[model samples]
Target: MRYRFESELRRWEARLRDDWYFVDLPPEASAEIHEWADALPRAGFGAVKVVARVGGTSWSTSIFPSASGVYSLVVGARVRRAEGVEPGEVITAEVELV
Candidate 1:
């Protein structure tokens, strides 16, 4: 199944050591992912594998649960370059569970 949503690319600092880029899934999409996760064998960190498309770039990654009952998709360096997206820029994303 596929889900689509729009969100801003956010930059977060992890442990005050390095910066990380991510997009938080919208509430509706997060709920759907949670439901799907309940039926699948999860990997480390209870991550759900997914293929995500942003702008003109598509890549495989996993969504991780957040304290706020949402999921966040990590945006890698390659994807950022390919998509030409930067932090705080809103972009449409299409994610397919894998």
Candidate 2:
């Protein structure tokens, strides 16, 4: 189904995309994403995007739902704005990886 993201999610997604970072959620992230997307009751539904900022350096992560359980924090997006090796810069969070 064609699930349109809510304004909140859309805003975050735009930022993430602009930053050149696709969601890097966990391997099971897809499972949760699929559940939510499936709930959309449509086809071609994109994954669930959240509005979170980068917290750690080594690994960017976020929590999402899954048919198997409640929450799962998987590999999240990368910081497109970050340059060199000087740690990633956190933005005012627009969208997040699902």
Best by lDDT, which number? 1
Model 2 worst lDDT window (10 residues): 1-10
RMSD of each: 1.3, 12.0
Candidate 1 colliding pairs, count: 0
- Taken over the whole model, the C-alpha lDDT of each candidate is 0.84, 0.34
Number of the predicted model whose TM-score against the real structure is largest: 1
What are the per-residue Cα lDDT tens digits for candidate 2 across 1-98? Answer: 11112111112243554522322233344454556654542322232444344333333333444354433332233443242222132222322433
Candidate 1 lDDT by residue in tens digits, 1-98? 78888889988766456668888888888887788798865668889888989888988888889888888898888989887888999988888888
**What's the lDDT for residue 25 in model 1?**
89
Error of 2 at 7 (Å): 26
TM-score of each: 0.90, 0.30
How much does candidate 1 score in TM-score? 0.90
